[model samples]
Target: MNDKMKLKQFFPMLAFASLALAGCGGSVSKTGIELSNLDQKAKPGDNFYQYACGGWIKAHPLTGEYSTYGNFEVLIENNNKQLRDLIEAMAKGQHEAGTLEQKIGDLYNIAMDSVKQNKEGYAPIQADLEAIAAIQDRKEIIAQMAKLGSKGLPGYFGFYIDADIKNSSMNLLQIGQGGLSLGEKEYYLDNDSATVHVRESFKAYMEKMFTLCGSTPEEAKRKMEAVMGIETRIAVPSYSAVQQRDPEANYHKMTYEELKKDYSGIDWDVFFSTMGIQGLKEVSVGQPEPIHEVEKILAETPVEDQKAFMEWKLINSSAPYLSDELRACSFDFYGRVMSGKQQDRPRWKKAVATVEGVLGEGLGEKYVEKYFPAAAKERMVKLVKNLQDALAERIKVQDWMSDETKKVALDKLASFYVKVGYPDKWRDYSGLEIKDDSYWANIVRSNEFDLAYVIDKKLNKPVDRDEWYMTPQTVNAYYNPTTNEICFPAGILQPPFFDMEADDAYNYGAIGVVIGHEMTHGFDDQGRQFDKNGNLTDWWAPGDAERFEARAKVMEDFFSNIEVLPGLKGNGALTLGENLADHGGLMVSYTAFQNAMKEKPLQTEDGFTPEQRFFLAYANLWAGNIRDEEIRVRTKSDPHSLGRWRVDGALPHIDAWYEAFGITEKDSMFVPKEKRVTIW
Candidate 1:
């Protein structure tokens, strides 16, 4: 969906840190840092990330299956094994029809049946393709786009229902620019060699897909050109990723009548009726320029060309579920070309991921019951409280903010909605049916089932603040500004993030920083716009807002200068929010760790002082290897800095880090106090 509310997470998708100290060829301990994991040969003053994580990096090199491999993947692999056992057990048992077990079991069995999938080939989507070919007029074409979009295909534009940005209580219909096969507009428009290579690869993949669907070579070439032309025209006016970050800039709410009159290329009444939405009075057009461009393309394009574009959308979206050949073709461009993943993941992994995606909360309910410990939740509550108290203290003492703003900041801090482990209530999958059918057909039905919920229950309803956006099995944490909440799912509760046996320093540096990072997101450039109640209203004093930006600007310029690759540099403005969260997380969590030590003092363990272990533990959370292609892709799309930079680029600005390592101005990584950012 185009207008999903932003949930600022610690990492991009599948992004998380691990602090498990086991399996590093060191003495096994229930607590403390992993001494063998550190590259003692490297100097901390010059490269702390390398010094702390070098040994781990050398031990765990990137494999063909991953573009990047680190502590997060280690945790993911462990979780997947547990999930596989659970799902496979269900698949092997006999359950009553319409039961949750039956649905999940049948879905997994069908996905794993490669013989059936290969036999079906593209037969499942042939009907949809025929419908596109049968279209005779503009209205028919628009109607077809709506039909495909309902099944999660990219149409000329994207539409969804979400909490209104300005009014956070009620759900509103939102539209934004989409339809580009290459997600980033830069890939289509950039003149760089890397971009051009990817562009060509995407084009080749498109032609191959057309040919696989029984098109002649000549016909496939013509269709590929038609689809590319349509998509390129749409990409021309689409918002850049950075531009889309500004909530106020992206949001343009208009009356239903105004929308129909201004963008009259499509029939609004028909579109809404087709989408099963009624009584729609207002809509938010996020990035209207691209929608206007799409409108022009739709109205002017030839009927045959439009049909080819629609067919391509269906083919591209359905390839993963269709056949092995189609799946490999899809992965060749997206996986091998874009991310440089040398090999495809195992089929069981793909099937497991599909089951999780469609019925996540269902799987999560069982996952929490089996894998998540009750004691972990109890401890997390206390850790969260300690971090909250620390943040409140920092806000109260901030010299850059006035008393008027300080009061509000502390109020926001106190009002934080903390969710640990899992949600109090889980989603019901009673209406979903899993039958013996084609995998692609089942996928479409699952998507429709989800869309029905959004249309039937969520539209025109009050936002459910208690609902969890992520599953219990997800190895991640997030801060949703609209809900003013911080969530730590069950998957991230285990080591090296939260070790019940580890001392305060290890836990504080790992999960403690994560908890504080989500808390600090409330005051980041975007999150700061939302008030205590989660409405997008500016509550800062005049001078305080200016001072916050001025301080943040230093962070922007600091990261912008660091070269992640030979010619590529970090996007300071794009990563400003995450950078601020990282900086603030360290400050708040360190204060909490110190407070923790005051009550129960800790002695040095594993030949490192408590302070040294704290930083080392934090660095270990980011230890792993990454491919250069992934580096380029992430630089263009990901908001979080590279893992190495998360440690290296971030620690330089942290004053406590200097004290922990005894670094002075003479150190290569030292920054003058005048230039360092002090914003929390």
Candidate 2:
């Protein structure tokens, strides 16, 4: 499974300014969910998103370095400042060898050591460059790819250790279609104005990298074309990002002997041996159709062209860690052209991000000790339970689902494993050696160490159900179908999403809904295919499954029909799972809110009823100012809908939302009862 559902497109940072609360104590609304951010001119029924978030959007415009900015960014910016203080303090303090602090601090110090990095320049990566240049035959190329893959530079395809979908108890080798430089197959295939322009820029980018690698001008041009040609061929075989969403379509188990017989361009024995992977009798190919094409591409392409392609891949992946010129060239295409960011993020921020990536859990242990309190975790537990109960109630009463399916659904819900704040066991970093000598070396070494641990140690072993894909410092949550678990990181347990002292109404609408969102992921269009044991077996009755699919199709069509830009429409089929979670979460959270108020009534404050406040809180969290370029990219790539559509798209489907906002048939966002899609 993938990591947690990311709310924002951009990476999170520290809050720029402390949110102005109404009171001196934590009881104050630090989340900024008041009506001040609303645009009174807009009718709530006609355009609820504009009504709820127009003022905030007007106040905050996109910054030079940010593609999108919103509540998540604000929280991250605040978090980054806290982390920056901790990092800076640790960097200055003395620590023992192999300590988390020492490793963290040394990594930070090396990254900031521009002089050392500049003096060494590309000299640090000379050995890797030489290895790629020395490639002569297919065997050497295959071995080199393995070497690079182990070092975190993926050369040909992707491989990872995941719990076998059919048997969740075992960790198995998963080989999937990868090796493309662009984000998706569409980038290479689509002939839209934007796609064509990006393709041309990417070709130029490859040429620039080849030239920088000391290739003659003509040689660079020819090599770049060859690399692009190879990539395009590979792209032709790969599934679109949307098609990859279907788990059943992708899952294919095979013995090693069977796989070799099916596609025999590269010797599996030699390749696996080179990768240092042993004792593997079988593997699950996520997409065998694309992999079969790899055999054809290898046979048709010359060894020289393949070498050029591999060389480009090596240089392209390592460019960011190299000298200023290479890094700048890399950023020019990926950062500026892709995301429309005119400048680089602050060096300290970048350094902090790098440290977090390598030593996240280690740093996360420190983050929780300093930030997350016992009370917050305790409160979250109750909130999660409330949402679970609400969802269970909805499932029992679902008119379309039969009693047989309901029983299985409840069983799955009962089996749900919830992890809050941090993992029960922390990952040991004592085995990963980090030094202050070289930044690039530390990164490469860390990648190798991680690969070895996963390939040599974790693979072929029993699955660790308690293991988390995200760090405690990550501002996100996830539902893993394979583990039948939902995780809430400490990073998301703050203002906007959750505030310890906020009234129950706001809490239910914000963090409570988020909790439900993740919980609903278990039964989302894709997630529901996996049973309680996290096995890919159908537990639903045939008729009930068909009914659910029919209802799901309505929501899919609704999202697909939405025009994000001229000639650009949202891919409903691609984002179906997320949309399902959104709709289901909203319904269940609203139920949980009603259940909460039955215990004790809350008074209306600032002229908003508790119900209205709940809806407002939910909408305000999605207040975002995004760049047009980012909009174009995310429309084609991201599975989650945009902030505007997250509100406008999902809200129209909820009957309670229309009643709370006094919506009518005349309203632009109005959806009649028959047209509204509700799977839950």
Candidate 3:
């Protein structure tokens, strides 16, 4: 038989024993299988929770959302496989682009295009060291910073660069502000390890820049060392402007006048001018302390690097807007660092990204119509909804949660908004300059454009609700309780995660579960702190809150007990919310499928029933493997569960599993009813 036939035959053989519904590896209740038809059996990787969660493990093989779905990813992948095969057959004797085959085939093509435009795939970028020689004046030295932000590092993106302050633990900083919603940094300190990595990386990267600009090799090395020394001192004073203004702690929220007093070096009028905001005297601020400190430090720097740095910084700060040199600089630095070769991505992907970056999200929407398409979004949306309904049922059954708390929980769940495959509003990149050639210069111009935008926001109103942090092409999804939103970009809609034409079981079990997982995040342990308004509030009664904590504690301790690696205590605290989401998401997705079947009877055209396909779909998601070193590091650092455990941790919570497989006290997944944990 051919590969297709072989794959078709293996479906039932692989799924038969696993259908007891004890967990992810089990079958019978997954797709078309009724709870009544389960055959009590043990399968591969038995006696281990890893196999029980076979579905999840297979789905989240990659770091991104499609593979790392809560449950539905595998189903999506299976669907995609079917579509891929069909498309391939259609293209075997036809042209590449015009034929429908280009749809699936273009995933790599687009990535190649983007990578080529920005990466140094074949060779290093042409950075003119002579530009450093252009600095005849002292101010010219600081002007070099214009080149730095555009070309070298990725520090100022949304993530934090923290410092561990003695006696000042990061408490009270929970919720969105805690990460994005927490109090300002002056409450913390610099010498903290949080700042250590960023400072060192910046210094190292800047030194490379200085070296690249040298006239002689010896001079290059010496200048590089000097630049490193200079950057280190600057970094000691550099703190995140945004972190200081987090609104949750009642931070900055100052007017134009107050902010003006706080950071004198940053021209309030000019910054406001950049962002197109007017009033500043009475508005709220996200951070005041860090902004104040940055101003003080900027004021104190020596005249040479300080002045040029400020000017260069001023220009580079304007994101989505850039000088020609800045844009060229960006392309060079990005193109060089991302790829070993001078170019990596294909031209079309690069064109798309560049167009999306400059033309705004509408262009992306149009691009996706031409490229990503709506069918992918529809598939993802369906799975997400199924999982959501399932979670609602799970919450209804939670014995520990009081009815009042459950009501509020249900309210939050009901209010959850889904944004699958790109945002309605694209970031305004029209202000950004996109010039020809000079990759390094283009990047610098872009930095100036972005920096200006951020500074402008200092005086502007709160974050735009329509604004999306992740690019449309990015393969990731996030649930922001502060915003009460879940965003799924187009990048993650392909392969190994989602497909429009896979077997129902796999598509729903895999990608459907993933959608459910992200949706579940709204009600996760930490996410619960934020009300439906996306503000931090404790609507749950004290008693319910305590009970919820108690349930979460069980989860935390459960993970803490599992040794992912030697001596590495699973940070149950960090992963508690994710684990909860994983558990709740899988349970709900399964139920949703059950509901779907009741309405439609799950008609199976092929040899496989929806039930058989579901388990296979789940397992297929976690089909890939990882390196030991990679696994070890992820265990220590990543908040999400390991690929294997994510499967195990979620599966045992399913009540249907115990019913289907007759799993008893002897089964590792069997938790006494009284000790069972459930939250939705």
Candidate 4:
């Protein structure tokens, strides 16, 4: 692949499992499968995704507020309702000062106070805007960028503290390319008609925002051009999403002195002081080329042009918290133009979402207490263990991997730490101050508080393994390579993903596969680079590593050829790890499900065999209706394949699935025996 086209998608915090399900379950039939979701006319051998999801897709269409709707959205809607109740109840009640509920309630009140918000239009961020306008020199511009960076706003670049890839025991500061109003570099550079249209829309959006900031049309045009020039320059040095996947390649450790000397334009001392860091040592530069590009831009770009870009960045970052007009302008571009949503989500939903983002763990504490049960956690524990056992057995008998590599893989499996339902310790939010006077101010403070918290936790402190990346209320699961752990939040441990009431087949196919998927990640392309302790290491023998890469290459070619939309092909290399996990998860979970069946025999239920029901449950979890625009975007950006491909692409590789459904070479879904790609 061309280096320019090899840009890897960066997950700033942690990587989540690729194969996950959505939502609470609906009415169960005798067969456990929601028969209403099945299209009886479609043959399983020809197109399993359609066979399994056709009816469900027909029943559910994309609403104005959504670009895509599926099991995940249904679950989110249910969870959002629950969150809404909690927020509303808190807003309605009286609580003491400095309490979690008080903060929640107060923020809710401020957000919903449209009259007050309209009266104080743009006042909350007036100080920040004025500060940006005051920047006349290069030093001031650098200082302001650092100030904005601390408040979680992108300036010339972005930074975060993550477990050091090499050490896996200490945290290090990682910096990369940023400052794009458009989310991705491809939006600024791609010559496709859709991409060109997006660039134009972004320019129009910037003009509207500049006008709202009290600029004349001429001034707005100049500012927009300056901003685009700087962003395009920054985008020039950005690595493709594919390049970011190789963690070892991205990790470049350097001292503060070396960095300042090497990239000489910016005053490192002023920037660090503004960020409240007294001393700095080593920092990991993620994409060094981008940083060099930034240095070059800083040296060559005029102070006025730099200020123009900075001003736009500040306004754009604060737009959501500004007046309704500004917020609507933002929505019109990012929402309608980008994702194809025709309308804004309800005000209450937006408010609830803001609160969740700011104080997720606090909200999650309440969520798990009321919703997640002890029995569900207990069941999940057993399910995970079964999957682990199945994977261990498979590793022991692998023909390609040497005995030495197998032993290490088994050790890594044994060392896996599992977190279910919720975290053992909830984050302390007492330091965060929330006031009802201004919603935007409270959000800025929240961002500052979060920034300080992250710095305090990582700078001189040991790595906190107990720290959870996601809140309990998030309906997602992840495997943290650095921590060597898999986390299943309480929000995801619900009916459709995992349910105590559901049959063994359903649970195994849903959450069971999820568990296996996470576990399989430890041995996937990127995860395999890390040892049991989560440090990036080559644990595999030389021959074994080459063989694994060869197999992975097969997967890359297979998915790259798949056309997701007209003239849009899936980026196989970009999605290789995820596709591998899906395949591995299904294989391991099927084995685990069979083992469970042996313990408690399964019979044909509701006219479907046990194996058939299991496969159907897997397919049903991903059934969704999505817009063409969204499909086109995901085909380029999303790491996971589309839901339809997740089913149709993965099932044919599984021997048991074919046997259970009586599929053969004559079927459309069949692949020649020699062509199937299977890597665990």
Top candidate on lDDT is: 1
Candidate 3 residue lDDT tens string, 1-680: 01111111111010111111000122333332322222123342233334434343444454422212333334333433433343334334434442223322332233233344344421223333235335555433323433442332221111111111110111111001111101122212344443344335433443433333222555434544443333344333333332222224433234456656765655546433433334434433333443344455445644434432332223223211222233334434333331112433333333334333433353444445545767777777776776767777888898878898889988888887777777775455545544444334454455456555644542223434455645554445667665677777775665445555444555667666667767777766656767776766678866988888888888888887777655545666656667887676567777787787787666553344565455545544443344443444344334576666665555566665555445688766667766666665
Compute the lDDT for candidate 3: 0.46
lDDT of 4: 0.81
lDDT of 4 at 549: 87
Of the two candidates 1 and 3, the one with more favorable TM-score, higher being better, is 1
Query: Candidate 4, residues 464-580: lDDT per residue as tens digits?
Result: 999887788888898889889988888788767776667888878888878888888899888898889889889998799998889888888888988887888889988888888
Scored by lDDT, model 1 comes in at 0.84
TM-score of each: 0.96, 0.95, 0.60, 0.97
Candidate 1 — worst ten consecutive residues by lDDT sum? Answer: 18-27
The sequence of per-residue lDDT tens digits that candidate 2 reaches over residues 252-274 is 88988888888788678777887
Clashing pairs in 1: 19-496, 20-496
- Give the TM-score (vs. native) of candidate 1: 0.96
lDDT, candidate 3, residue 526? 56
| lDDT scores in order | 0.84, 0.80, 0.46, 0.81
| Order of quality (lDDT) | 1, 4, 2, 3
Candidate 2: regions farther than 4 A off: 1-32
